[model samples]
Target: MTIQATNLGFPRIGARRELKKATEGYWSGRLEDGELKDIGRELRKRHWSLQAECGLDVIPSNDFSYYDQVLDMIAMLGAIPERFADIGDGKDLTTYFAMARGTDQAPAMEMTKWFDTNYHYIVPEFCHDQHFSLSSSKAIDEFLEARELGIHTRPVLIGPVSFLLLGKLRDEPCRPLDLLQRLLPVYRELLQRLVAAGADWVQIDEPFLAMDLDESARDAFQQAYDGLAGSGVRLLLATYFEGLRDNRHLACRLPVAGLHLDRIRGNDHLDELAAELHPDQTVSLGVVDGRNIWRSDLDATLELLEQARELLGQRPLQIAPSCSLLHVPVDLSLERHLDDELAAMLAFGRQKLEEISALARALNGQGDQARSTFEDSRRTLHARSSSDRIHNTAVAQRLAAVGPDDVVRDSSYPVRRKVQQAHLNLPGFPTTTIGSLPQTMEVRRTRAAWRRGDIDDATYRSFIERQIDHAIEFQERIGLDVLVHGEFERNDMVEYFGEKLEGFAFTDNGWVQSYGSRCVKPPIIFGDVRRPEAMTTQWLRYAQSCTRRPVKAMLTGPVTMLQWSFVRDDQPRSDTCQQIALALRDEVADLESAGARAIQVDEPALREGLPLRRADHDDYLDWATCSFRLATSVAGNSTQIHTHMCYSEFNDIMPAIAALDADVISIEASRSAMELLDAFVDFDYPNEIGPGIWDIHSPRVPSSEAMTRLLERAASVIDRDRLWVNPDCGLKTRDWPEVEQALTHLVAAARTMRESTSQRHSA
Candidate 1:
């Protein structure tokens, strides 16, 4: 059997985030067009060279993107929304970016989490009359570019079926899948072009096969591939993030040259797949963990690969990462600050490639050649399993003591709402931010300086306090009823909490891209989580002192902290989440005791962490919702508890969302034009809700009239009195000028809605 080492995809954001700097510079007009393209070319060439150096035989091309791969596919298939038609043809950067970031004339396309990952993708908008054509030559160009660099790479495409499934209908009475027949010609043409450009194999990623599918979807997949059957290039169909449980026969029987399975997530059907494989087809085993930082347990993984090899005698077998390495940091060696002991247990993108190559050598009967790598993996696994740093008996005992009452609030949401409104009386249509204000260059510089010991504690604290003063003054001046402390003292929502909490470790440069030009260095939860002391109390107290308006104490919720962190796989995720919840519960009690009136625990990742399969949803949601309640249950009825979620499909999880029992919930709505509110409307969500009026993810500043129109749409679905005004998410990514402009419009929209409501009541 021929054995090879391959990669599904690589992180497009460079090790030091060069792409972020270049993209943002280009967006700000600091970099010329040629300069931006030069940077992208340099990064791609460097990435290809790195993979080749690591001994990967089947490197992937066209996996890189300026924004997201899905958006790239949209441009490739000419699926640009009608609003962007006048900008240019779908090929230019102006129209491409306009669809992702929005212009003064059009709002940005809707964006949400890609599957269960924190990586966001620009949602495709499809009209009933959507036309399909080969709009961009990115795939063909990248394949030829790799060939020029002496890398015969496999070009990756988002499979036609999965692409259509990932999109939403712009108008009713039309299905995105119905456009499949029209979309297939574009895929076929792209494959033909790649074949003409000297490509032999193409990896078509159909990740939706891992999710639940109907018969129609299965039919669509058959139709899509059958149309491309004779495109003259070998096709490697890839599925990841899950296993094809029921769709196994469909996937295995597809008319493709090969099939790649995520052996990590869905390994139960491996033997079944081996039994069902056709003689002409190859099987690629995804053995390495692509979404995590932990080193692979190579001994066990080798055993699994050997089992597959035995079942499929003399068949071509490939070893690769379970999915794309885009979810992980680019390099582990750059993290010098992490001590040697802790660092030994981790693997980044480059390290994962080495692991893949080692596995392939072992599978190829060259185990002795890769002996040192195998020995290192064995030692790391042994060290991690036996590490004393992993377990905390005290934390375990505290978690054991948790009871049903711990997850229950003292009163229902209605009772708490009455008490909260009576104690903190405010005007109708109250406006608040989703925690953070802009963390400007000064704030970032001060924090960095303090970390580097260039500035003393007093100086940093004084600077943070001044920034808080400015934020409070701005809110009060803008006539917002509720306020936030701006969170200038914090670096990230998750990392800030993890720094104060025990059982967590951090890396100086373990950055992963969340979305466009946005990178997050997720903290690593290596042991039983425990709060060392009060985390945000001092800052919240100082901010409240500067403002008469009730300042909401913002904390990252337990689920988000656990979801965002690189968690230890030693224990069940639910247990670590519970430990985190208990820690946050203590913080909630302390903040309430410190005279904080309202507390917002942001759980934006709660929905992002939902299990992809429907059968597993209940078990995850139960523990997830329980964890959130366990954190906020300590708050008194008069102490308002709030939560925030963004860029998620809430339609399926509306009941679970209600189970959290937060007094108020704010969600992202502006990008979808308040369409996400339909879930709340259909469920008749009882608690107060702040359907966001401004899309903070985009750089464009919205006008008061636009925000007011969105509020009107929200009011049509939700009660006006129960509604609040807020931005879709935090303003930390945006500049102060746009934030001030956007929130000014937000407050104005609230006032306009309040006046209209009052007039209607008088009438």
Candidate 2:
């Protein structure tokens, strides 16, 4: 038996990002239902045809989504919440989008982090009395749609266990797994429909199995598969992100026909897994890297597959990616602006598909075809691996020269706090904002005009400076201690810097959706990463010159800059991150030299970069935290280094946050009602902290009393003097009126805190 090619998933954002444009247009009343459906059909056809072209033996259907897969699962199981059901059955496209992104009249279900990725999924809400049935048949419909195009495909679904695990109970304590006995019927019905539709194989993804699971959760997995085992379709139980360590015995005992393991991230499990595979079960080895832009080392991958083949002689082997291609960009070939040599060193979603196919062909003895592509890939890899452009000898020497003492300042936190307090003395309780103010429609229009040459550089710069001046003057009037220039000129914190750096390339339309109606166009780092000149010096200097109040020089930290962008595949990520850190190190020195007293390097994506498995988190955090220190450690004792993180649950990563050694950290805590402060209390963290006083996700301005109550909660765990009051995140998404109103109450709350503290001390 030979290895067959398969894909865990492919990019759903159409080649032209037609879905993004169509969804936005439909929401804005610019597109008809017919137009949107046509685009969807075309995207599915293109995706299927491309997979077929890559010679994939098991091409996946039901993976193309207008929004997200988790939402699709909610529709498939007919688990529509009561509020959403009023919009009518799932067939109505308008109602579907309304559920995904609420209308003017209806508030959408809360969207939250999707397993640490920037991509957000609509959280499924289940009431205590919830019942399940097959509500929508999207899986069957998409499978049929692909069959009509003459491509027989295996349908993909988020497994019952993972679906229930990822979802939340609406104001109830019942675990979703508690409903497994009832939910089994809906999944069975969906499977039977696919089986009737002539699907021979079905892929059910249960990624949560890679995480730490209790005995009950493990038992539920076995129980869920027992019902699905007899469904006629051959079941492929896919687990990615990391290997099944503690759960390996349970996985081996499952009744599923095959198991898919991510070898890229879980390479350590290869030998162990080979010895544990059931005699009758098939093995799908995910040797291709999915989350990164790196090119595969074909020789190494082939050898691993070959070893697996030897261990499980007659068992069928399937080659695939470690996870979905949703985390990566589409088509490296679309990058026309990148230099040819650098472009050859990278692989996007489409190229990854080809890698899977090539590996399969090589294993099947079509050695010549495989050899041709392998040699080409190797040539590109070797050339980039040793290229003079990528290696800055001076930078590498500086990294070697760095001592342990370099990461630490001259004095400890106690001494530095005293110096900082005296330098910026103002009030007992201080109020400031996380960098950006707002990116209004006018600012977007001006940037667009300048890009099209409709406006000159001088005109654009003058407009941005005016916005900054207004932001500064407004903050002063509202009695803010520290102020921001509002980041008016930046398209994105990282993209703007990436555009100015030497080793990066930008696309006109490389937009990837970060959350509901918010998209980020991540720049492609195509060569050795180095800042040829200062990326943010001019705007930062200009803003500092205008404000008498201490204006924090903002820079996206090294780890975050790498995490958010399409990084170069030539070097190890740790090495590439260090390159970015050194570049920022120079900029940090410049910011301090230019009379700036504080600098906030935002690493919002740091937690997102952690490996899915608990065992791997420590090593990942080590490099990630080290990169942050390398970026900010250049500052002198008086320069207060601040870092901002948004929408992150920091309880688990508290030690890593503290290790960054920033003078102050402002985190998104208002939504959690200062629940994150519990970690600080338990750990006795000594650094200054800011738990957000108000949630900025909504337009409603929080009352001063509300803000005061939140600050009081923070004060219980953190020292009052060490607390800084701020919003949950940046104000780019909000309007000026909302920003002004929110900060007004924020300032008032700090005033109340100071007065209460004075009375308490006097008493």
Candidate 3:
């Protein structure tokens, strides 16, 4: 039997992010649904062609999503939320995008990092009385459409167990897993339907198997696949992101004809699979690295494949990426401007496919035949080490000299808290904005015009200063205690800082999706990082000049900057992060020297960057927390160091969160109605926290009463002195009107909270 080369999934954003443009156009009423649908079709055809041309076997269909695949699964299963049921039953772009991005009438569901990766999925919402029907046949139609183009592909589906496991059940004692029995028939029917549509193999993703699962979740998996049996379509049970550590035995015993293992992440699981897997089961060995942009070491991968082949003998093994290529950029070939050495070390989706194809060829008795490819991979590995562009002796010497004292404040938290409280003279539950005002279309227009040479630096600076003045005036009118410079002159938090720092390079348009309708062009970090000069000191100084209230010296934390960028793989990630930390240290000192009293260094990506396997998280948190301290430790006790983290459950990382030792931390909690604050309460958190009083992801303007209610709920658990009032995250994605209304109520809510607290104290 020939070894099949397969991809679990591919990027759906198209080569130029045509889907983003089309979707945004449709949302703005500039493009009709017909135009948007046409773009989707063209994008799908192009992607399928690219995969086929790369010589891949078992390509995927139904992985293409206008928003998210899980949301698509939600639509396919007729699991529409109660509020959006009025949109009618169809895979209409209006209803789909509305669910992902909220309308004026309804709030969007929560979005968080999918597994351990940067890609965000709209969290599925399931009620206690959840029911299912096959409301959409886009999956089957897409599978047949690929056949029309002569590419017979496996239709992929998010398995029922994993879907409900990732969902949230509201106002109901029934957990999502309890509804699994009812949810299985929907999948069984979908599998049979795909088979009828001429798909012989269906790839059902159950990545939750890679996570720590309870007994109920494990049992649900058995019940799911058992129910899915006899559906006539051969199932390729796929899991990625990490290993099946404790779930290895359960995975082996599942009654499926084929199983796909992520060899890159769970390389240790081969022996377990060999011992426990049924001999008749086909094994799809995922050897290529999928979550990152680094080129695979083909020489090493070939050796691993040889071992796997010897172990699984005639079980019809297939070659594939460890997971989908959705997390990385679409193609490396699209890049026009990268230093030759870094380019050689990189592999986006297009290059990963080539590597997978080469791996498959080498295993099929073509080792000598792919000599050129192996030589190139080996050469890049050597060249990167010796390349002068990658290392700096001075930077290395500096890191070697850093002692533990460089990462800690001289005073303890209690001493520092007393000094900070006396210096700032702030009231209980002080209110502040999360470092940005709305980046309106006019602001973007001015920026785009400036970049295109329609205007000069003087004109741009003048416009930004005026905008900052307006922001300061608005904050003063709203009675906000701590003000921000509005971040109008910046594009992205990390990218804006990265452009000014040494040892970094950027693309003209290297856009990658952060979520639905939200794309970020992450700056690429190369060589030894350093800050030749301050990134935000001048802006912070200027904004402070406009206000008597202290304007925060806002900056992105070192761990976050490193996590968000396309970092170098030649060295340890911790080492690169340390270099970044040292650079940010210089910037922090500059801001302190520039008369900035409050500095908010945001590390929103901190929790998202933790290892998938809990066993590996300690080493990561050590360096990550150390780096954060290294960046912010230079400030005096009077200089309040504030940091912000957004999304993902922080309950697991609360110890690390406490270790960072920032004077204050603002986290995303309002979207869950402050459910996330229980971790702080349980930990007996010492520092101040702003549990984001309202959800910034939605367009709906929250009322002052709602904000007060959330504050009261948070106050029930947290000491009032320890709670700071803020929004869920930055308001950059919002419009001026929405931001204006939100902040106005936010200030009123803070005042109301303070008054009530004082009244209770007096009584």
Best by lDDT: 1
Model 3: worst 10 consecutive residues (lDDT sum): 85-94
TM-score of each model, paired residue for residue: 0.99, 0.90, 0.96
lDDT (tens digit, per residue) of candidate 2 on 1-763 = 7779999888788656778888778766898988988888898999999989988998999888778788888877877777766786766776677677654455455556677577777667777777998988889999999999999998999999999888778667788888888899889899999999999889999998888898889889999999888888899999988878788888888898899998876754656766777777888988888877768888878888888888777888999999888777778777766667766777788889999999999999987877877987789778877787766677677767877766666678788888988887758778889998889889999998998899999999999999988988999999999888889888899998887776777765566667654677788776667777776777778888887789888999988888888876556788778778888988999888887788999998888888787777898899889889888888888888999987656788888999998999999887556768879767877798888887776545778998999999889888898888899889987888878888999999999999999999999
Task: Mark the regions of model 1 whose C-alpha exceeds 4 Å error after superposition.
Answer: none
| Top TM-score prediction, candidate number | 1
Ordered from best to worst TM-score, the candidate numbers read 1, 3, 2
Residue 113, candidate 2: alpha-carbon lDDT: 69
Candidate 3 residue-wise lDDT at 681: 65
Better of 1 and 3 by lDDT: 1
CA lDDT for candidate 2: 0.83
The Cα error of candidate 1 at residue 61, in Å, is 0.4
TM-score for candidate 2, please give it. Answer: 0.90
Give per-residue CA lDDT, model 1, range 432-539, as digits (tens).
999989888988998999999999999989899999889999889988888999889889999988999999999988999999888999999988888888999999
